[model samples]
Target: MSEIQEEAVLEQDQIIVESGRPKMLGYVFGFFAVTLLGYFLVNRYYMPAPAVNTAPAVRFAPSELLNDLNKRLAYLQNRTTGVSFYIHTIRKKENLWKLASKRHYSVHAIIGCNPQFETYDVSIGQKIIIPSRAGTLHPVQKNDSWQKIASRYKTTLPELVKYNNTALDIGYGDLVFVPDRRPDMALMNDKLREKYELRALFVSPLGGRLSSTFGRRKHPVTGQYKLHGGIDIAVKTGTWVGAAADGVVTLASDGVGHYGKAVFVDHQDGYVTHYGHLSKILVRPGQKVKARQLIARSGSTGRSTGPHLHFTIKKNDVSKDPLKFIW
Candidate 1:
């Protein structure tokens, strides 16, 4: 060999000698001959390997864990979040807490979803979002307590306090969030608005002119003095009946008598109103009714010849002339 080739070979031998590692190696048939032989023998049934005592892996899905947590913590979450309806959009690098603060939601609610983070620092494309009410504020009223506020907004008091930081203040007029109650309130509000083109304050069920006054009149059927408890409207027989106020219908009976088909609505204000001697009763007992909801078609039935509603206003269970309450 030449002198350079001889020197290169000598250097390689020296490195192998000092490091004792095979950096430049041909194909190695077995890394460890003894272990390889033993493994081969066991697989071929020459020798049986010792059994390994290993526990089965615990298997669970992230969604299942979240579901379990949600099921157990539903009440707590509800207490913090309240009933709501919202519109939300996902944005970059926004965290649940920050989004919640900006749009107003519970941090606990944000954590409930268990959002994902791509990097230690939030990324530009990272998405964080939540569902909540938008631009709806409850106008504060005098003597409004937390419970009253909650009732007005259709939310629990605890949720109002938590979401709006209301518990921090014991004084009156503390700002509180009105949870946009999911499912019903929004639609109901739409219905109310659609039905009443004018503002809700002026459209009273008793707003019509008192066409026919109540009490002793020359009876169209009987010429005798009979106690006329209900007022008669001068409208036609097909005139629609309206609810006097927000109430639950206690009874809707059609049995023919002095009071033929009758409707009794129990207003929560410790009073009830009765529409008697009608041809039709549309509502059933125990049905919750909104103000101005259609309850019956007016017609003359039983102990009457004219088509008019024998409307009576009862306060504290005592029947009073309907004219005193209605217009």
Candidate 2:
């Protein structure tokens, strides 16, 4: 009876051990499968995807890029019309003076447009806005005619009208945009040449014959060889002395050495004229005179032998031959 019981118990124990090992193996496999499934779900649905590069690899040179940008900007500027504004970026070695001169604008005009610039001092890379054209704003006054206004501003009537987009008759207190109206060198030279060609038709400064020429000659009073800087015209005493050209009187006094009662007229076009040996000065400094206008009376004064008018012409402060211009 004891041997049969022992053998049965040993077989039952071995069977139980084998069955428990199989269950443990199943549980381990199930746990591994669950973890793998969880990782795949999270990666596919919840986690962010890896970044992908999409930009091109090519690069551009700085100069080429700048040139391209400038070309585009120029094209845009040219296409703009009417009253427009310009944004200027200050460059190296640039200042208000250089900018105004290059653009043919006055420093005041540049300052007017850019009031934000507290001072004339400007720095590179600073941005400023200005008008494309150069000019100033003028207020119309009573009794102001287009011709008078144009003449005052040194511009043509047509240009004034066009720029202001106004009628020929402007009202009092109306504002007008007056552009720089002075003619260029070429046009001025042409006008001067034409005027000299018709000198006979134009009024002469004095109705007298040429007494002395401009050059090196023996001085009449000094009795020495010296340079005669001007032409001498012998006219009767008290003869009316007329202006040779339209200009402003810059000097009208007797203090000028060797030229008593001298009168200097500035044509405002780089040309100036001097009339000396006058007895009476009819104009004052800053007085505007017209061509053929009365300026003084002739007399023998300031190292002169007789009553005569010594006339001199200057261009850009350099003395030039009066004969070449007197005709």
What lDDT, from 0 to 1, does candidate 1 have? 0.54
Q: Candidate 2's error at 90, in angstroms?
A: 65
Candidate 2 residue-wise lDDT, 1-327, digit = tens: 599899999888777677898876887799999999987765434423222223322223323322343432332233222334567899999977678778777665665444233445679998765566676445456798766777776656555544544422356644455665322222123444344353433245877888998899999998999888889999898999999989899999986788888999998568889999999999999999999899999998788899999998888988766866664
Tens digit of lDDT per residue, candidate 1, span 148-193?
A: 7666656564455545433232233222345543222231334333
Note the residue pairs that clash in candidate 2: none
Against the true structure, what is each candidate's TM-score? 0.36, 0.40
> Against the true structure, candidate 2 has what lDDT?
0.67
The TM-score measured for candidate 1 stands at: 0.36
Error of 2 at 260 (Å): 0.9
Best-fitting candidate, scored by TM-score: 2
Q: What lDDT score belongs to each candidate, Candidate 1 first?
A: 0.54, 0.67
* Residues forming the 10-long window of minimal summed lDDT in candidate 2: 50-59
Please give the lDDT score at residue 204 for candidate 2. 59
Count the clashes in each prediction: 1, 0
